[model samples]
Target: MPMPEQADAAKSRAPSPAVDRGLTVIERLVTADEEMTLTALAKATRIPLATCASIVYTLEQRGYAARRVVGRSHFWRPTLRLYGLASQLVRKIDLSSVAQPELRALADAVDMPAHIGVLDGATVVYVAKAATAGFIQFDTYPGKVSPFNLTALGRAIAAYLPEDELAPLLTGLVGGRGPAAGDGSAAAFRELLETVRSRGYAVEDQEEQAEVACVAAPFFDAEGRVAGAVGVTGFARDLVDERRDKAAAGVRQVAATVSQRLGCPATALPRPETVF
Candidate 1:
């Protein structure tokens, strides 16, 4: 009900806040269609060009913004450090840290390499691992990217990824062959995911290497999401029928103990000695 002049003057007189500008700059930089320029960032955030430069410089110093030499004018994009921060942020429950002791024990029990890996984007990255004192020991260092379709631990973790994310990675493949010509068989891969989900464990029989075999079970977090995978791997020739079941059972027990320690529900875990 105020006069037009009064309302207009009031709107014009309202003080613009600094936090909004800073956050807008950050958002635009993060989601821009292409690499952002200092001028474009300033324009997008409606901040002064000089202020944008200072803000970008501060962000660069903090390792949030990175500048590249595209031509005369510099371009900016985010670094992998952003994903590092995001990974730590998303993992409210630290399954890898809690599974260390059990991992060591499992490694000793199986006398092979046991590892714990969590799904990072589309890859299973090793977070913790132990190796037995065997002559043909396999090294599993932290941050190794396991193949989703070619490894037991990878299958267990990948089984829990959202459908949209899991689909593209597993688009092709008919009976282990490359994706077929319009077969509508992607449904089978989804069924495989469900089979892993229902069975509670996954097995890789010489999938990653001609001589290697692995068995893995899922570790649920506090919220009951598949937080990671705990598994053991050894030479296929070394494992006879008697040892395979024992190894699978041992891996399942260790995975459940780790899940329980991470606050997952008792009913959420699968039965031991069952393979998927």
Candidate 2:
């Protein structure tokens, strides 16, 4: 019962139904486990078949979706255009800001100090940290830099690097220092990285500091490359056997969450069982 002018104004401000249906179709295609036929997409979106076809065809023209012919039917799937836009948005965000809340959650869950670190040359630099209340804290800070082989955070990130990139880092660290417990030589360090890769997580058991231990897992970027690592540090006596396993699982889960937020596909992440 409104005036004609008022009704026209309201209609003009409303969202476009066509745009909404087009987005719905795109989302359905993107989330489908396999390429969807136009019929399947229409059924999933509850849009009419001809309308869905038009929407998909428009998407294909815009480089957002691709069509494949299988048998007698055509199947549609989302292209990398959406992923490229997502990658650009993620690149503009800060890694530490994205990881801070997850680190805090990890600290509370494990009752220890949790941290995020990034590889810098031959060292790993801590960029953010969260400590549980009433817990004994370690002598670490945001800017603390430790040799790559001496910390779980470093090992977690290094384990995923290609040999061509890892060899130089190992050479620099081992050749410039005396034999250490975890990194005695380049060969030994390579062996350790192999173990870390197999397990999907890394552990530092009193290797760097007395009575201190840490567990960490790597998180990747949209390009499926290791971007950084998340770790929890505590007393070695407290992080043993079952406790260590639990902490390792927690760290892996948190890292996976951060990776997904950074536009990494779920398929690219390590399986949960691999952490154990």
Candidate 3:
């Protein structure tokens, strides 16, 4: 169907045969209607039996696949723990006992998943979390260390600190780039933190993960330091458009409450725009 020169050009532009064959094996495993044996995988992928076995071995080592131990041989299955690790990190941050009762009240009042987060080096760690009572809810536990640039909770805390105070905190923390914090992947975070300072609250839409949104406000201590933040996150479909403001209000109220509990007076509450 093609001219000889055109056919030659297409062949030259194509991926190496070994690379294409390897990818084909992976694609077949991903789209299979049923569990595939090494023989079946090799046949479907048009790869050698030894090569297919080697690919499976590599996938298993990386936690992408696991042996099911079906019959006399092993069947590969995907491990879900990779996804659960994110939640586990959030659950590890430590919150004081005094903060729990207020966190519980805020969680119960909003009927949404809520968490208390504090700065831990360069990351914001979830010190505590309360799951909603509803049948469907965002599931988070204490001690999760969410990416600072990617979460409303982190942004809210970033919003209130003085630029000098916060900049070094950001630059000194893990993944920070010294004085030039925005030189690398942290540029987005630097920009977002600036926006959070301009806005009254931090709002996130599908930043941490696709289809999840959140709103957060920061808590300040009597000394005027950024102590922590409280935020709510849920399915994006449930909290789209007009609902964002309500979530932001809730976050502000809870953050204010936590600040008051930490001995910050009503008059001392730092406005989002004033970084003092």
Candidate 4:
């Protein structure tokens, strides 16, 4: 038998030239600004033209790349199947771990507690948080669940969901047990979602607790889908009126950072009137 180090080195080497060539073609298609013809792919990857044609044909058959024919020429580009596979892997990532650093930074910047939450049916479940020192701690922790319409974190994500998905969540929301809860009609809630989309963030001014409020913004995954949200919670007095804009900006910035880390393109992020 070979020595252990040699065996390890052998295991690390490319095992299949055909598979390597196929992956190279796929990468070239994915990174190219425009579709490439077979000749271009062969030249770029330095594979024989016949070999490159076979690789691309296999990729096309497997739904990883697509072909477009113009007149007699065939051009190829990557398909969303690759993105779908990537999104599946992204979904398995520990979202709380990904957002924790940004959550801490947001808490320190806003001098309040910050949280990250994901949607669970019609509710938002807090999965991680960063608490500030010297503040009266709010009654919230990881695993806390709140109605989607009653918290800024929830609203931030809900606002970006498709209408078909949001409609079911809005069905039974009728003025929950919050001091500031009001106008739970679907029409009113739809209007609120529109505002969230327009402003690039959501606010719950004393909607969950009599003395507390939150400002939040949605984060996205590589597929441009709402993955979760990041929010800061503070006394209602500190999060409204003159102070609200600063807090909202901080929350949006954290959301943007976390979303980018999750593979969301910068262009896919929300652009409120106030640039981040």
Candidate 5:
């Protein structure tokens, strides 16, 4: 057998031409400002069409590339795999310990339930939660897995995600955010994400729960990437008009605060918008 040091050296090097080509394909896809057809990809990357097609198939099987029709043309685009891979660097972060106290504070400030969640696969898993006083029989808590395309907290995290990653997931949202599924579908949810991106937060507005409404904001980590999201949930009736506006602002403030605590650079605050 080869020595340990030799094995380590071999592992660090590009294993094969195929691996190098795969990475090149991903890089070419990701760096382009827009999607590319096979011909476009070949012209851009100088790779043979058959090889490019094979690379795309491999990438699709690995969930690294998806065909999208959300904003641009129906062509292959990069997926959240990059985000997921980058987040591995933060695996050691104790998010619950880092943000629990702030979550409690946010809940108290807004007089409602609050949650801290991180993306796991296609969902956001609640890692910490602070419910309002006198709450009982709650369905959401630590470890609750929510689909990223459905909940306010999920969209909050999704908002900061690149459009390439967000588009494919939105295509799967069926019943809208709440009971108003009649007009709400994939296209509407895409529009909603656009609003969230522009406003720097997300609003549920009883789109998921009949009686519950939520306003949420994304938080960045030390690397300046979205580490997670924080949201406040309350009765729909209680979160109307000024109360809703206040809650959205409060939630955003808390998220920014927590993000600063997580070592993100201080930045200007987001503009206020009502949960509605």
Candidate 6:
């Protein structure tokens, strides 16, 4: 047993139990597939009911979490505040800065319009674009966003997603009436995902933009998370057979180069097709 003074001093220096409880609650709600109730959160964190309630109230006040009341029981879950903050961090990333050279090289190698895009909700947002020197290419530009199921860029990222995560995404995209919604149902969607995974890239042949063809490959970050994707777009006729295959190889090569620069292991590289 220690003296009262010593025990009190040590307790004062420790981290706030309230803050620890709050953070643990946030993590639990964020990772949960379904909403959790106040009792559940308190039990999961082993925090006293009153303290958990107070922390949850504070989070709600800050718009970081929300609750749904059903009769006497209330369910709580994290809100999109984290996602909004994440987007702010993404803006600071300057993906185009490091990826410009690769984008340009891809455009030159593929002789088409090249773009780097990141997944934004159910859409893909183009952040960088390059065109073959002196060659006119139309339709895609920086800041443009397209439905995930309709763009090769989006599908590339989707290919690497776990089934649990991918199912809801594809279902949501379909619910939004994306152009590809008419193509098939759940089974067909699964097949599309399977094809993309097997090939190491996603191919869209005149699927989104009329007479336009595209191939895209996803790139990983230092932690091996899919950071974004690189893609080449061109006319349908120009993207057939050897041409399409070659472009796929080029896209994978450039994405791999960038991924490597970001510290991704060579073993993790997804090479769809070998250069002929």
Per-residue CA lDDT of candidate 5, range 1-276, in tens?
A: 999999999889847877777888898888899887766876787778889889988888989998765565448888988889867846756777776776777778778888888888688899888887784535788999977766778888887777787767766664644663344576777778789988888887666657777788898876677878888878778888987777778778778877887778786435444332
In model 3, the Cα lDDT at residue 231 comes to 85
Q: Report lDDT per candidate.
A: 0.75, 0.86, 0.70, 0.86, 0.77, 0.81
Q: Which of the two, 3 or 6, has more lDDT?
A: 6
User: For each candidate, how many residue pairs have backbone atoms clashing (under 3 Å)?
Assistant: 1, 0, 12, 0, 3, 0
Pick the TM-score winner: 4
lDDT-best of 3 and 5: 5
Could you tell me the TM-score of candidate 2? 0.66
Q: How would you encode candidate 2's per-residue C-alpha lDDT over 1-276 as one tens digit per residue?
A: 999999998888988899999999988888899999998899999999999999999999999999999799998999999999887896787777786777787888888898889999989999888978884668878899999888899999999998788878977763322223554687888888899999999998877767888999999987799999999999888999888888998899889988998879999887663332
Mind sharing the TM-score for model 1? 0.58
| RMSD to native, candidate 4 | 8.4
Residue pairs with clashing backbones, model 6: none
Q: Over the stretch 1-276, how does candidate 3's per-residue lDDT look in tens digits?
A: 999999999888966777777667666776777677787788877788998889878878876666667778767654565446545743552354546665676666656787888877667888778777867756566777866756778788877777776777665434432232333345666777778767667877765666777788888875678888888888777676656666666677767767776667888764332111
How do the predictions measure up, each by TM-score?
Answer: 0.58, 0.66, 0.54, 0.71, 0.61, 0.62
Which digits, one per residue and each the tens of the lDDT, describe model 4 over residues 63-180? 8988999998999999999999987886788877886776787788778898999999988999999999983688779999998889999999999998889889888784655688
In Å, residue 227's CA in model 4 sits off its true spot by: 1.0
Ranking by TM-score: 4, 2, 6, 5, 1, 3
The reply for model 1, stretches above 4 Å from the true place, is 1-93, 172-188, 271-276
Give the C-alpha miss distance for residue 155 in model 5, angstroms.
1.1
Using alpha carbons, what is the TM-score of model 4?
0.71
Q: How accurate is candidate 2 locally (lDDT)?
A: 0.86
Runs off by more than 4 Å, candidate 6: 1-93, 133-135, 174-182, 271-276
Q: Write candidate 6's Cα lDDT for 1-276 as tens digits.
A: 999999998888978766777789888889888988999989988888998899888899999999999999999989999789867765666777667876787787768998988888888999989977655657789999998878889889888876676778866653333233345466776788789878888888765656787899989985688888889998888988988888888888878877887768888776545442
